[model samples]
Target: MSNSDDSRARDRLAVMAGIDVDNPELRRRLDAISARTAERLHQPVSLVSMVLDTAQFFPGSHGLDGWLAELHGTPGEWSFCATAVRTGRAYVVPDATIDPDQATNPLVTVDGVRSYAGVPVIVDGHVMGAHCVLGFDQHTFTPADLAELQDGAAEIGELLQSYRRGDTPA
Candidate 1:
């Protein structure tokens, strides 16, 4: 479902994710986290994305240059993170080109993101966003991969809660 049609719980979590909060240190920390996750997962991209009604904002990201990862955000329909939120679980697509569910996704067709692994970042029992890794080459995700992503998502969730609590990064 679209963020506009999302549950109040989801909306609350999004608010808790501090989408409007301007914390440069937090952004830097998140970006570093994304970089680490990408390296750990051997993926080309990793992102801490907050889903919005019309778009998804990336406070943290790796493997994306100014070519497409705009400050304003990409369209929500183009976001795989939205799928994680919709499922409220880790979503994996081994090969977007072959997966019926993801084959036609714009991110796959337009940007050539072939494989994806995303874990929902929940706050107050609602999915606010996702910690995601993307690959340009197709690679099946194993249970272990899912578990690692879950851990990363958990860390993201904790950091988000701290942000909401006004805990500044040192």
Candidate 2:
């Protein structure tokens, strides 16, 4: 399929996932996971971000401040998580300032996000979104760090699946 076709399909799946961006209970559960991920990874910020057609929604977030915390999301162009969703793989930026693909990203140039690591959150065989951590200073993530991030992503995927099945996740 073409890129646009693939994007459309993914967008459809995101909609069908039925993630209520404003559901306080869901947000609280996801926030707990985000907080744990940040503590485990020793990162300054972590987010459970759902990439939609126009934007990425932060249903779960930790260590965010100011406008980002208030907005709970950002436009798709600013999303590092969108790369994870599109590729269905982990996306890492060891140093956004030096990476050609990330050098101009606002989260880098504007928000001072120097490093990022993200893993896809999948549900029902579809790439739903991402679980990601961000750092203010350049940090080269080890394989173990990625593994821990992947575990967090898996937990998020399972939670999303539970929601899809109309079951409250414990």
Best by lDDT: 2
- Report lDDT (CA) for all predictions: 0.80, 0.86
lDDT of 2 by residue, 96-157 (tens): 99999999998888899999999998876777789999999999999999999899999988
Model 2 vs. true fold: TM: 0.90
Task: Put down candidate 1 lDDT per residue, 10-84, tens digits, no spaces.
Answer: 566557655434577777788888998898888988988888766888888878865567663588888888988
Task: Count clashing residue pairs per candidate.
Answer: 0, 0
> TM per model?
0.86, 0.90
Candidate 2 off by > 4 Å: 1-17, 165-170
Model 2: how far residue 72 lies from native, Å: 0.9
Measured with C-alpha atoms, the lDDT of residue 61 in candidate 2 is 92
